[model samples]
Target chain A: EDKVVQSPLSLVVHEGDTVTLNCSYEVTNFRSLLWYKQEKKAPTFLFMLTSSGIEKKSGRLSSILDKKELFSILNITATQTGDSAVYLCAVRGGTSYDKVIFGPGTSLSVIP
Target chain B: SAVISQKPSRDICQRGTSLTIQCQVDSQVTMMFWYRQQPGQSLTLIATANQGSEATYESGFVIDKFPISRPNLTFSTLTVSNMSPEDSSIYLCSVEPRVGDTQYFGPGTRLTVL
Candidate 1:
């Protein structure tokens, strides 16, 4: 069975603090790892990583993948109240590479 | 990325009723999917809406309870049948413009069963 796991199921931090979320997976035919931020009902795509040793960044959010270790990390710098949300990690892998397994997610609360 | 939208942004229905949610993409997409998110839970794939074919459902899901339709490449629909309190959830549709592409999700429909 394919599965994705995330550490620190919940977290709390002050504004301007930095946080790192971890995701590890075990699946066959690993195709890609993706990160999404769910603020309300819908989840917004943040990053998709297919290769290792390379970082993908967008403003204050950055992510990296380690294919060899079968894990990925998402880092948020200088967090803000607006950043409080559930950070999800998903891995696209299966016999046909059409399956997407999501982690439990990390609930982050950034307080002032 | 294509713009995706879902209909009936939300609804409150009585038990035993059924609700159908529509998903439309601004541009044609190759793949579309339906997902369910219960309160405080992660997204669970319901099915893959294949154009001109029967929707593929995941394990623990059935076609009778959660029927899907994909008449074309840019549109799809998911119907939650025989609703119950346990069926109340946020239903989302996502589109993959092409094979191996990142998926973009719709705004989602919030359903509450009474």
Candidate 2:
């Protein structure tokens, strides 16, 4: 069974604070790892990490994958109230058409 | 990235009733996925709807409970049968383009069974 686990199930931080969310997974054949931000309805895509040590960044949010450790981390620099949402991590494995398994997710609250 | 549109954004249904949610993608996609998200919970894969085959269901999910139909490459439907309060959830449809593993999601349908 492919399973993904996220750490720091929930967190509360004031604006301008930085936070790091962790996600680790165990799968039969790992293809890629993806991150999403969910506010109320649908989850929007954030980043997809396929190679280790290489980081993908967009504005204040960045993520890196460590294939050897089978883990990944999402870092938010100078968080804002808008960043308060559930961060989800999912892993795609088995085959190219395999289903994605998601982590429980980290609930982040950025207070103003 | 593909754009997905899910119909019946939300609905409140009575117990034992069934609801069918529709998903339409702007572009043709090889694989479309359906997922269930309970309140304050992670998204769970319900099934993978392929263009010409029966949807492949995940563990803990059955075809009878969640029947899916993929008539084409860009459209699919998921029906939640015999609903109960416990069946209340937000159902989302996702599409993967070109098999790179990045998935784009539809806005989702919020179903509340009372």
Best by DockQ: 1
> Candidate 2 — which pairs collide?
none
**Each candidate's DockQ score against the native complex?**
0.86, 0.85
What shift in Å separates residue B36 of candidate 1 from its native position after superposition?
Answer: 0.4
Regions of model 2 farther than 4 Å from truth: A95-97
TM-score of chain B of 2: 0.98
Error (Å) of candidate 1 at residue A108 is 0.7
Q: What does candidate 2's lDDT look like per residue over A11-112, in tens digits? A: 999999999999999977888999999998899999999999999999999999999999999999999999999999999885444668899999999998
Error of 1 at B95 (Å): 0.5
Model 1 chain B lDDT-worst window of ten: B95-104
Angstrom error at residue B53, model 2: 2.2
TM-score, chain B, model 1, is 0.98
